[model samples]
Target: MSHEYYRRGKNWFTAIGLLFCVMGGIVLIQQLLIWGIDFVEDFLFNAEFTNEKVSVAMLCFGIFMIALGFRKHEEKR
Candidate 1:
């Protein structure tokens, strides 16, 4: 019984982490693209804007992943 419990716990961790990684990959890709576009547009025309928007957005997304991980971890606990 204890072994089964431990196995399930490990599985939960793996699943949650993988979920973040997969979603994070997609989000990170978009964030990178936004930076690339923003940079090109700004450089070509001398446009100034909030440069931190992309970073902040990425942080928020990371927070979401952490929150989701916590949720799954709590479910097991």
Candidate 2:
């Protein structure tokens, strides 16, 4: 396939949206790691703490924004 997705756009939204997507993905993954650690702690030490709802919501929102940004590119082609 062509490299259209990587091509730069004339506006700022595409870059910002991509950044948001990347950051959100990182946050989500970090939360996953934290959840895993908490799980281990709960199993071994009886500690209890796990909450990723906010991160999950932000990740989904970021993905939506990324898709919205891509609409600009699609319109240009």
Candidate 3:
């Protein structure tokens, strides 16, 4: 029973992570095209929450979640 719960949780994590990754990727690409790489540097150095920053955050978080889900799945084996 608990194993089933874990499996579902892992699936959810992976699914949500993928969604975030896609959304972030789309936004990041759009921002990059509009503002170029210089904007990325600005966002990194500046203490502001811009679309690029949010997208990067989302991308990082998504990757972390995906790794967590996969790690859990492997541990179950």
Best by TM-score: 3
The positional error of residue 76 in candidate 1, measured at the CA in angstroms, is: 18
Q: Model 2, poorest ten-residue lDDT window? A: 43-52
Candidate 2: C-alpha RMSD to true structure equals 7.2
Q: Residue 55: error of model 2 in Å? A: 1.3
Candidate 1 lDDT tens digits, 1-77 = 55344332444444655565566567545655777766645643554444344444545566665566555232343
- Better model by lDDT, 1 or 2? 2
Give all candidates' CA lDDT scores: 0.52, 0.59, 0.80
Query: How many clashing pairs per prediction, in order?
Result: 0, 0, 0
Q: What is the TM-score of each candidate against the true structure?
A: 0.34, 0.47, 0.71
Q: Which ten residues in a row have the lowest lDDT in candidate 3?
A: 1-10
lDDT score, candidate 2: 0.59
Candidate 2 vs 3: which has more lDDT: 3
Residue 46's lDDT within candidate 2 is 39
- For model 2, state the Cα shift of residue 72 in Å: 4.7
lDDT of 3 by residue, 1-77 (tens): 66556544437777888999999999988877888989777986797777777888999999987887676444535
Give the alpha carbon lDDT tens digit for every residue of 1-77 in model 2.
Answer: 57665565464565666676677678657655767756534443433333344445566777777676667445345
RMSD value for candidate 1: 7.0
